[model samples]
Target chain A: MEYKVQVIVKPLDAIANPEGKAVERALAALSFDRVTKVRAGKVINFTLEADHPEKARSITEEICQKLLVNPVMEYSEIQISQSGN
Target chain B: MDPIIKIVTFPGTNCEYDVLKQLNFLGADAELIWHQESDLGSCSGIVLPGGFAHGDYLRPGAIARFSPIMEQVIKFAESGGPVIGICNGFQVLTECGLLPGALSKNDRMRFICKTVSCVVKTSGSVLTSAAVAGQTLHLPINHGEGNYVCDEETLKYLRENNLAVLTYTEDVNGSVEQIAGISNKAGNVVGLMPHPERATDPLLGSTDGQVLLRSFIEASK
Candidate 1:
């Protein structure tokens, strides 16, 4: 089975998010004052072959643990869905 | 026999030659090792020079950690061989779990390139063994994401174990506790943001980097 996977990676809340803060300041400079707590992260999407949805999720989780995520500073959220043939 | 040092170069790594030149000048036989090579092949020390490894894709050092050569690098470090990761190489060390903490985007979100004063905090590590505590060395830092961050527990461990080897004289990039470099508990592996290779030449404005690199070369022996 083919599954589509998306991983959302971001710095932990305890870690400083300078890019997010810079974006927030830019937004405020543009007079978008209502926005607060702007945090920035990256999304990675890819497709892979797996025997089942659970297997795909596990594989995605493994990938995140091994490479996609730095547990010291970043966290990742993985989303897996069955791909349409 | 003169100690042999291996400088590992990833595809985007541009500092390999600089490091090679500096190491050779310092009297160690240093060679450039490609990222795909599986074996270190009897080298006394390994260095990961600074650059945008894997083009800094995903993140600095993120993709490079998965390269074939890194497995051997990790094993070498585990076996207590001296290893130092400079700049982006430092990022790779943290990403690979060879060192603690992560290098985050600069606090002001700017790529800073300039010389900074770093105080050696411990001479226990392979990188700082030649310097005494509280000795300040001027080294150049060039990076977009050099801010280092780690959780409190890890910070405490680093502090107690004297693993935090070098710290900035001031907050250069918002690194926690002004830390510019650190070593693993064993003190064989070290990672730092500043470019020691760049400071080896007096013409480049400072010879302070020689102190650190010399320490690493000595440790490799």
Candidate 2:
């Protein structure tokens, strides 16, 4: 089966998100003062072939641990779904 | 025999030649090794020079960490061979887990390019073996994501072990404790955001980088 994987990577909460802060400041300057916080992150999407959904989830998690995310500073959430071939 | 220092170059790396020229001038046989080569071939030392490796895609060094040459680099580092990663190379080391912490976007979110004063906090690593603690050196830093960050536990460990090698005299990039560079626990692998190779010439405004590079060469031998 083919699975579509989307990995969302964000700096850990303990880590300072400079880009997010900058965006927040820009928003405030643009009169969007109600915003309290903004955290910036990236989304990585890919397709993979796996035997089952569980296998695809494990594979995506492994990829996130090994390459997509730096555990020291960033955390990742993996979303896997069946991809129509 | 002159120690052979291999400077690993990823597709977008631009500082290998600078490192090569400086090492050669300092009495080492420095050579460039492409990222796809799986073997280091009897290298005495390894260097990952500065540049926008893989165009800094998917974060700096994230993609380059998977390069074929990194396997050998990791092995060489494990065997206590000297390895230094400057600038983008430093980012790669952290990504590959050779070093702790990560270099994030500068606090002000701007790319910085200037010579900054750095204090040698420890002389125990390959990159600082020739210097003494408290000694100050001027080196150039050029990067957008030079601000280094890590968890509290890792920061404490780095402090307790004296693995933080170089620190900015001032908060140049908002790095934790103003740390500009750090070494692995074994001290064979070191990473820093400053460009020591670019500062090796008197004509370039500072030759202080020679002290660090010389230390690396001596360690290689």
Candidate 3:
């Protein structure tokens, strides 16, 4: 089976996101007053082949822990779904 | 035998020559090591010079940390070899978990390029062994992501272990506790955002960097 995985990496809440603040200021200057908060992160999409869904999730989680996300500064949310075989 | 210091160069690394010249002037054999080659040869020390490695994609040092040569670098650090990372090299060291904490974008989000004064916080670490604690050194820092961030536990550990080596007398960036540099638990590896090699020559305006570079060279020997 093939699984579609999306890993979203974001700076930890305790850490300041300067880029996000810049974007927020730009938007506010443009009169987007409704947008009160802004944060920035990256999304990584990949396909994983595994015999079981559990296996795919486990592998993706491992990848996130080891490489996709830096534990010191960022955290990641992994979403996995069954992909067409 | 003369100690050989190897400067590891990634594709975008531009500071190897500066480090090489400084090390050579200090009477050490300095060689440039390619990022793809794993062999460390007989070098006694390693210097990861500054630059945007692999275009700083995904984050500075995130991609470069996986370079084939890094395996040997990790081994070198583990074996108690003197390894120092300057600027982007420091980012790479943190990404590889050889050093603690992470360097984030500067608080104001501007690229900072200026000579700043740093207080030597620890005299026992490999990077500061030659400098007296509380003494100031002027070094140039050029980077966007120089603000260091870490968890509370990590911060406590650093203070308890005396791993924080260099600290800005004032806040240059919003680095936690103004930490400018730190070493691993073993003290064999160190990472800092300043360009010590650039300040080694008196013509560059300050020779304060020589104090630390001299310390590193002596440790390597």
Kindly report, for each predicted structure in the order presented, the TM-score of its chain A compared with the true chain A.
Answer: 0.96, 0.95, 0.92
Compared with the true structure, the alpha-carbon lDDT of candidate 3 equals 0.91
DockQ metric for all predictions: 0.82, 0.72, 0.77
Q: Which candidate leads the pack in DockQ?
A: 1
Count clashing residue pairs in model 2: 0
Per-residue lDDT tens digits for candidate 3, residues B82-199, read 9999999999999998998899999987999999999999888778999999999999999999999999999999999988899998999999999999999888899999999999
Over A8-59, each residue of candidate 1 has an lDDT whose tens digit, in order, gives 9987898888889988999999999899999999999999999998899998
Ranking by DockQ: 1, 3, 2
Candidate 1, B69-98: lDDT as tens digits: 999999999999999999999999999889
Interface C-alpha root-mean-square deviation, candidates in order: 1.1, 1.2, 1.0
In candidate 2, stretches whose alpha carbon ends up further than 4 angstroms from where it belongs are: B1-3
Q: How much is the lDDT of residue B72 in candidate 1?
A: 96
The lDDT of each candidate is 0.92, 0.92, 0.91
Evaluated at residue B9, the lDDT of candidate 3 is: 97
RMSD of each candidate? 1.4, 1.5, 1.5
Clashing pairs in 3: none
